[model samples]
Target chain A: MAKVGLFLGCITPLRYPGIESSTIDVLEALGVEAKILQGTSCCPAPGVFRSFDQEVWRALGARNLALAEEQGVEILNICNGCFGSLSESSHQLREDPKKLEKVNNILSQIGKKYNGTAKVRHFAEFLYRDVGLENIAKRVKNKQDHLKVAVHYGCHFLKPRMLKEIDDPERPKILDELVEVTGAKSIPYKDKQMCCGAGGGVRARTKDVAQKMTIQKMENINEVGANVIVDVCPFCHLQFDQGQEEVETKVPVLHLSQLYVLAFGLPKERMGVEAHAIPVNF
Target chain B: MSEEGEPKLVNPEFTKEVIKRGADTITLCFQCATCTGGCPSGRITAFRTRKLMRRVQLGFKEDVLPSDELWLCTTCMTCDERCPRGVKITDIIMTLRNMAVEEGHMAEAHKRTAGMLIKTGHAIPMGDKFRELRKTLKLDEVPPTVLCDPKLYEDVVKIMKATEFDKLIGERIDG
Candidate 1:
């Protein structure tokens, strides 16, 4: 059981603390030590900030990664946006020495630096590649035998394939396989790999466009009769969980950790299940 | 060939700027609508990712910078991932956005969110509802983040200041 720093992005801690709670609980259940990397700022949100200024995006991302690098542990990020920013920054900074020197110069002003030692891993990848599905399945005290789930990979988890390299961008299975390990069937849906309509700052800048995309995804989820929407990133979770409210759909949403927490037979109360906009009754 | 032909809208400098800003692949886009065809935002909004790619290639800075469609991209990278030409469509959009902001063309909503980030280190700052929910989860009312720690918040402010993010976004950071 290696020590991994949990990078809880802005939305997760502020909007969906339950995901954080569940992630911590599930990691403990699997005998992995979870350390909260304190003093970190936003993933600065890749879409909004990066759209306006790449240097600020890179520097802020480097700062967050520097925090984890100082702790000497790889990051275990639960949100796709954080995974994109931190992982992409680490990759870009390490691959390009000029960019590394430039970012380090900015970090020096704040007395921090990124040597690119800290690697960012999405939680689903952490489970699939590191924890092993069999090891996870062995601990499922309560099999979600009747549960049907629609897995939302969210764009950052698999996109820009050269950088993320988590799964096949066109056809992702790591998340689906993780869901299946808990006895829930990961149902295939139309445009299963489509963006959650909230990425790249769409939710903030354009409400109707975001809701329209959410409705489209919900229609697909509803078409498949999925009882729950399983996602690794909290931003995508917000789009499905809260975005559905505008469209008048009630499809329940669960973070991957929440499902694992349930499969471990942990009480739902421990994970703040009721806090969701759409109730998770299972 | 008559001298009355429509005036060219090209501004090669804009194209070169986008390329320098990391959208270097814009030149390879080849007018293929594959990006727009596969774009989820294109399906609903007025945002045409392919058209935007072409606009950048033609260097139509005025037409591209001030349009509301510029802010509508979700940056999903779906277009970039599936592009036949590997045009890095999303990165191009991001570069255009940066250029747009430099020209004072940021959408109001995005500006508001940027202001919030400068003020609180969060685009969507925590409110009372989240505090109550966190209490129910038995976690601290504010998770261990910049929200809970002023020192961290100051550190965030320092980074924003160093990067001139506050100034770029027109935020005034009081010492």
Candidate 2:
């Protein structure tokens, strides 16, 4: 139960504030103080900035981490992409003195210095590892056994298993186990570990290609008759939530935090189903 | 050189540059195609991660950098994880992309995204509509990001300037 600076990446705050509200609610219920990291920017986006300019990406990510450092807490990211950028940058900055010097050089212009001590945590991993499943299970006042969730661990949260080491990249069970804690069934589907096709700047550059990938995953989810898609990244959440409109699928999407909010039996309005393209059926 | 004496497309310097940019694992790729086999984007698009790695290893800078297929990788790291030779496939792709941007081959959409990040400190900048939604959610009008404080945003601008990212994308946008 360490304090966490809730790192709200762009999509969660700008596009899906419900995830923000619900995440805060769920964390408070679980007895974790979720501090808002003011003056934070984008995890600067991994695929876009990292692809375009690694130097810029590291500098911007360092600034965000520095913000959390000033608050004296671990940076808790709910989005897989944000986790990927911040954690990767933080890891590199910590391990490589030369790279740390380079990023600090950039930070110096902003009146900041990165000590490379900033720790980044994905919220799901924090809950699974720190909070423990039994504790989460105990807080579920409203069981969502009706929700057959197609759990998406999203790429960065698990893959590059060399770095993340969360679960078996090919056969992840973290999300499934977490989902089942709320009395929901995590339905196994084909290509369970597939990417949402929106990462690496592909969604922004090539919409049709991104949609094709989403449709493929949706087909697998639909075949399994999963009632909803549960994702850990706001980017993936956006892909499934909005991509459903193009593919004409009714399976709603929810961030893991939002799903927990529902399981906690908090007010439905806080989940912000109204902002969703595909309605949350349950 | 097939007797026609066509211009050589390879540039060893380009290969050296990619390695210098932190994807030295590019040399480890023996063209096993393991990177392509599991690539979700390659299944539907012309993006072949294995081929791209091959081109990089061969120093075919022209073939490697400017191709639209370079941007098609979703960087899922499936290929990176599955590589038996320990090639950091996604990292190589990212390195190639950075090199591509340096050569002025960025896609318009990605350039626009970079523009947004430069302007608002977020790749996806805030819209006026989200302000009302935040108020309805009983949250702050702005979510305490760089957008809330001009001085903090000025700090972001300084970082971008120091990195010359403002010059990289800004010059192209105005040009």
Best lDDT goes to which candidate?
2
- TM-scores for candidates 1 onward, in order: 0.95, 0.97
- For residue A12, model 1's alpha carbon misses the true position, in angstroms, by 0.7
All DockQ scores: 0.73, 0.87
Provide the lowest-lDDT 10-residue window in model 1 chain A: A241-250
Query: Which pairs of residues collide in candidate 1?
Result: none
Can you write out model 2's per-residue Cα lDDT over B1-175, one digit (the tens) per residue?
2134786577899899989888998888888898889999999988888888888888888777878999898989999889999998888888888888888888888888999988899878788888888888888999888889999889999999999999999766766
The deviation in Å at residue A125 for candidate 1 is 0.2
Task: Indicate the residue-level lDDT of A31 in model 1.
Answer: 82
Please write out the lDDT profile of model 1 over residues A128-210, one tens digit for every residue: 88889989999999989788898888988888897887778998788889999988898999999888898777788788788
RMSD of each: 2.7, 1.6
* Candidate 2 deviant stretches above 4 angstroms: B1-8
Candidate 2 global CA lDDT score: 0.88
Each candidate's number of clashing pairs is 0, 0
Which candidate gets the maximum DockQ versus the true structure?
Answer: 2
